[model samples]
Target: MTEGIRSGTAVGSFWAEEERCGGRAVALPSWLLTTSNEEVAATVARLYGGQSRSRDRQQDLFELTLDNDAIAVNVDGPEAVVNRLVLQQVEEHAPIHVCDGFNFLQPMDNAGDPCGCPESVFDRKAAARSGRGPKPDARLAFRLAAAPDLVIFHLTSSTWEFSDSLSAAVAGMERGDNGAQMTISLQRKAVTTRSGMAVSYVRPILSVIQQEFAAPGQLRLAA
Candidate 1:
């Protein structure tokens, strides 16, 4: 018999949720892998074997704790990820403008005219931070290396670091003829601001584990 129909293949999202602390939102230490699909929840439970909990009142949001700093992943190709800059007004669901930092991917008026965004990534980041322009919007889709056939897990981030590293990472992956094996980790770092105040934060990192390029007169073989 044919397999059951799959409507939404995305299993879940790996992300960090902020908590209320001292009347302000603070980032949590570990990442949370949450899903709303039952099948995805079951798959996650089977693979990770972690204690799952309902995070919402409707009991639809199932959250799995990822205490480890890193997880193995397999990316089908560069096309599996999309990183862009988007500008949205307050309470707007759709962005007013979108670009790749250098060029306008979505024109302001859909007239094919230039968006006039800053050409430099730094300048664009400043504009976004100052609420004058777009901010980073990135998404990645991959399968767990431990259970490749289970489901596709996704991660979405608006962090500037992730956006800045996308081009270089994708370029390295493109060098290979097939998919890439990689590790997605949460890296922690501390920095002192010019004001002499030290701040620490955790950011998600994507490190390619292996890239196989085709040799002269031969097709690349899968690992």
Candidate 2:
């Protein structure tokens, strides 16, 4: 059976409302703003302990997935402030399993018997790359789930460490390097479209950022 909200694996979309909490432009001590992308990535990985899988220089995007698939973090940087720190939850039998060029299926699996469809399972990477995959799953979006250590470690601890890193980064910036602006946005994007998110789940995460940086008046929370 597939994991995460799966009962018997009939291949249904994991539906969740995508919610957006407003974001604010915050100021960092110019010192922290000067660190290179490499330094920022290192600091995030050390604190999160996730394996770094990919980095795109053009996009200034860095991706890391935790050992347990509990979460994946995307750190976009080299801009004024780190553009955004996005956290996406990992689901079982996701796009990684789909063969290249095959249309992406909703769940990409079988209920009782295998779908016998190439798109349902892994094929050559090139094949999967040939064409656009299936449409994004409408029910899917990035959000926090309350698993054993997920909330305490991934949500609380990870955010805390990231904040510390940013603070340290600012301290290292040269005196008077004040041009970039950075913000952390916790959001939910549907596989193909926008989705709705719950306010309850969003509030605490916002609170954490507020307490960590805004308390000293260094940053502000827009939502």
Candidate 3:
């Protein structure tokens, strides 16, 4: 299926969305990497846990999945305590992006699917910062942080900790009970094409930057 929704699988995560929901979508697909010393997988986990550092084996791999109405993510490989990527109930039509390439698909979930979206699925009111861009060039811009230093962490069933910045850890809070994933990606896009985002939302750009190393191992979402 070049572009068809799929269901049924030991999903690491159905993948996350590609839209910058904070407001003013201003980024093109790009590549944001940490030093070779920083493990990519561990850096991914901090996303749910916030900015925390860990010396655990959780720093394995990062997986993103977007299938139908579901957006899943696994910060590290299996075996992490705060491992939670299995989130369903996403916009009906959304982008299924990874570090390589992605596509859009509508949801076909059944009764067992995650709940429904509390708000409008395609609500772009936040990400659509519009005014009058030089007569109107319908294109949004985002700055890409190239080779920023990233720190990945594992949240024990306890307090929050980080190897980078405290802001990263605080941002990882979801509903209230911060018992999940957290990762912070940094570098500095110089003149990034977009606005405020740590590292989690820069995915669309990462996919494009990984073109050269686009091998099976270099980029592949877990199933």
Candidate 4:
């Protein structure tokens, strides 16, 4: 019965389903942690001490209402965050074209050959905004500073500004030791286009709080 289930030949996956929080299910974009999972709601309550209200979209979803827009987080390392360029037909499905702004990570042509993409980040952003290329697919994983031992939370965004600043953010994280402290927040900004049309939007922001350092005696001992 287990003949085809050998250690190396097994084809099943044991990955746990990740609990997510975002503003997609809400009528208006906000910083509140909105999720449909009970586990996520409980975690948010324990950490942030907020009451949840049922918000109906196509179905019932809970919004974890908190007072603050920013939350302190502890990241394992720079690897916990990633940003990529992706193009897909639907929001819920996997992307057809995936790239890193310089090269294609997945083949876009029927011949199994990688297709050409914009050589510069600016050009890539323009193409994506114009619906001719891939857009940013940014993901982050971290634990709340208040409950560092609790469950890890994941957040995803498609904001171009967040994607553009990822390189610098990762570089800052690299300079810090393991389990770096940071703050994740939502920032709203308004700008006028060249045609004098004003637009307002909110984008996610991540900033380093403090870097851990070795004790002076420990450093001397190591030296």
Best by TM-score: 1
Candidate with the larger lDDT of 1 and 4:
1
Model 4, position 125, has a per-residue lDDT of 75
lDDT tens string, model 1, 1-223?
0011122457678875343533222455777788878777777667666566546555768887765778887777655677777787655556788766655776555534567888777787788777899876776777788887766777766777665555556676556546677777887999999999999998777777775422122111111
TM-score of each: 0.77, 0.21, 0.19, 0.67
Q: What digit string (tens of lDDT, one per residue) describes model 2 on residues 64-109?
A: 4432222322111111122111222233323433211223222445
Clashing pairs in 4: none
* lDDT of candidate 4 over 1-223, digit per residue (tens): 0000111111111111122463222112445565556676677677656665466563546666564667887666655666777787655656788767656656545323444776777787788877789887766666677776555556656777656555455565566545467777767778999999998766777776865522111000000
Ranking by TM-score: 1, 4, 2, 3
The lDDT of model 2 is 0.25
The per-prediction CA RMSD against the true structure, in angstroms, equals 7.5, 20.7, 17.6, 10.5
CA shift at 174, candidate 4, in angstroms? Answer: 4.9
Clashes of each: 0, 25, 41, 0
**CA lDDT, candidate 4, residue 69:** 65
- In candidate 3, which residue ranges exceed 4 Å CA deviation? 1-104, 109-123, 127-210, 214-223
Which scores better on lDDT, 2 or 3? Answer: 2
Q: What is the lDDT of residue 35 in candidate 3?
A: 23
Native-to-model Cα distance after best TM-score fit, residue 197 in candidate 2, in Å: 23
TM-score of decoy 1: 0.77
Instruction: Give the TM-score comparing model 4 with the true structure, all chains together.
Output: 0.67
> Worst 10-residue stretch by lDDT in candidate 1?
214-223
Q: Report model 3's TM-score to 2 decimal places.
A: 0.19
